[model samples]
Target: MSKTKNSFNHFAWEYFEGLEKTQKGNTLIRKKGRLELICSYIGNEPISEIGSPRMLEVLLDIQANSLNKAGKPTDKAERCAGIASDVFIYAGARGFCSSNPAALIKSQLAKSSYGHRPAITHPKDFAKLLRAIETIVGDPNTINSLRLLALLFVRNGDLRRMRWADVELATGRWQLKPLKGQGKVNMVKDQVVPLPDQAVAILHKQQKINGHTEYVFFSQTAKKHQIISENTANKRLKDLGYQNIHCAHGFRATAKTLLQEQLKYPLVLVEMALGHTTKDPNGTAYGRFEYIDDRSDMMQKWADYLDALREGRDTTEFRADAQNKADSTAQLKALIDQLGEDKVLELLKNKD
Candidate 1:
């Protein structure tokens, strides 16, 4: 690792290039870069190396303080701690270190009030961005891959590594080798992400690629058996004037917002659809139990939601149990409570 790069960066290149043919490996490389930036405020050692309790505490302090330093209002430090916990657990499993500081860090996380805010892209703007993505990936070969992207709402890298034999068109499910596996995966851990009709359309397109290749989303410049580069989808989005408005990752964020805000699905369902591995501070791990039924239904609904948005339809109705609305109420309550009930009554009286 460069004195410059930190955390998971030490082995990121080896980690990334090793799986050149698989899209997930490529994304890990980019995510490592993000992790490296995050480490700039902490330290440069491999995360596995810093698993001692003392190191963990120091990391917690640094993370909490870094948010303050950024001049943004202090977020619930628990989320940052949660991210740290997942990182340590992941690093430790890889034999990078003996202990997990993130676990220790998580214990301390409970004491800090939830201050993190979920960053999301607005649905209307996201719709504009999707239009751009669809337009950019319109070539016969890339279009199926790109359309399937929004349908599954999986990470760009995972989508790129999709293989031909993985999909069962009649069943509408696409099998994916779990990207987040830390240890040698059991057959049980190999994932099969359910595909919606939107996702199915792409499968049909991919079938026409003409090459008897193993990969589903084959790019011309791909390495042996490899499909797309880690950055291709986002790079294409940039070309279409969308710029920073959307990214390959932004799709997940957009889905979260729309699922809860627009479609009114449960928070648990939204998180599951995104394949979130970490749990909330309240012990809500995303995929510990198979969410097959819940995720399948949610994904189909989500695909429909995106379809409506893309086509500019005005007739979709969200389920009544949506989490985004609940979140709004809670946020409003917080803001109003902070201002005091008396103030609210006064404002209400004035409005009349």
Candidate 2:
């Protein structure tokens, strides 16, 4: 293909098509939307002719017009700038453009001033939210779906696109594909979430309703898709009067806080459980399934703690148990460092 024939529109379409192949479910929809916004503002000019000036114009236009979930006007200059940068980088790599002009003005884009997603960080507030989730009237699937989101605390996109084939109920495991742009090439692997018994029960109930469909939370009214809307869980929470106070994504913040502060789980383990990539002391990437047994135990304990909070039960015992487990893990690491793996194993075998 001639570089002159590769217009911005053509380049964008081809770029997003590549993204569709590599990315999963709703991720493509979002990238397509972003591409549309870029194309609409930047016109179908030749890819080589589009430079920093055209990119800045599009960024300014998006900043003045974009509206967030609440339909309030907000600046999305940063997001548009990012999309432009990526598109131009791809174009440059393919020899459509000599340089990535979008990257030149990326830092000039206005930063988003939106506050963090609201979460019930307080124990009393979280307890009340849990109670509200339990009693909220609607489709049983919707209710169960929200409950599972809270319990697992995974991203909304991942939760809605959950495939039944990825779940192993017998082993209480949910295998999650890496999000868009996160996988083997990125040195990230598929995340394996150790589902608690409560999470398993929720899945069982959901299975009864949506077993026929590939997605656990299937949308019957969707024209060509089986997965539920990305906004379904957030909308349900908003309906129950949690519009600003809580959202589907806020469950992550809630879990991060409670798991670390109240439960005393190590920060590294918590981040790994959240499917975030972390590095070791020597800058080596940790495996996705690292600390599987400990993570499973932590998840179950986290679920039990949530239940205790909901029922207004004492959590002192749970805290103690978590502390003891952390201590045991620390001691084992120290022993391993002092003695080789073979010696440690032999000592344990002799004790047994």
The residue-by-residue lDDT of candidate 1 on 1-352, one tens digit each, is 3533335554444443543545544345555554454455454665555655655565556545645543542433444454455565555677766665555555554343333332236777767766766665345656565566666767776787777777788987877755654343322235568788877776776777734787777766776545777767666766876555566666667777777777777776665556655456797544544678777777777777777777787625545454566788798798797998888778879999
Query: What's the distance in Å from true for residue 25, model 2?
Result: 3.8
lDDT of 1: 0.61
- Which candidate gets the maximum TM-score versus the true structure? 2
Model 1: weakest 10-residue lDDT segment is 110-119
* Poorest lDDT segment (10 consecutive residues) of candidate 2: 180-189
**Model 2 lDDT on a 0 to 1 scale:** 0.81
lDDT per residue, candidate 2, 77-184, as tens digits? 676666777888888998878978778775776555566888888888999899988887867768888888888998887888899999999999988875742633
Clashing pairs in 2: none
lDDT of every predicted structure (CA atoms): 0.61, 0.81
Reference-based lDDT, residue 69, model 1: 40
